[model samples]
Target: MEFEMIIMNLLNYSGEARSYSMEAIQFAKDGEVEKAKKSIEEAEQKISLAHKFQTSLIHSEAQGEKLSISLLLIHAEDHLMNAITIKDMATEFVDLYVRMSKISNGGC
Candidate 1:
């Protein structure tokens, strides 16, 4: 596969993951635990797809093959990192929302 194709896939997956993570946090803020869980699941799926692309490159490199680096490749990696950071932060924010909900319901 071409490097451009890989980078496009990475960007797509990262965008999907980031959107879902944001939705998950919004759901939590709205006091919808089930919906938040579903959104988080969707986010995880996207992240998994991104990981697949990353692993393919790593596997090829491990076989002494070269993966060309380009501007798009670097941008895709940047997007992936941002998505991952957002995902982690979203999880924490969701947890905090749950705690707040519990407290409001008098059982925190």
Candidate 2:
């Protein structure tokens, strides 16, 4: 795959993962545990795909291939990082919400 295409894929997947994380948080807030979990799962898959692309770039660079660092690539990296952070936070939030719900319902 072309470098630009790889960057674009990273951006697209990262953005999608971030969006799914946001959706998961909202669902958790709304007390939709199943939906929230599903969204988190989707986000994880996207993040995994993005990671694969990132690893490919890293491997190429390690093989002495000169990969030009572009502003777009930096932006994609930022998006990927943010997506990972948000996904992790969303998982915590989901767990918190579930715990709160169980506590409120007297289920311990």
Q: lDDT scores for all predictions?
A: 0.90, 0.99
After superposition, candidate 2 runs with Cα above 4 Å error? none
By lDDT, the best candidate is 2
Question: What is the TM-score of each predicted model, taking all chains together?
Answer: 0.94, 0.97
Candidate 2's residue-wise lDDT over 1-108, tens digit each?
999999999999999999999999999999999999999999999999999999999999999999999999999999999999999999999999999999999998
Structure candidate 2, residue pairs in collision: none
Tell me how candidate 2 scores on lDDT.
0.99
Q: Which regions in candidate 1 have their CA more than 4 angstroms from the true location?
A: none
Q: Return the lDDT, model 1, position 78.
A: 93
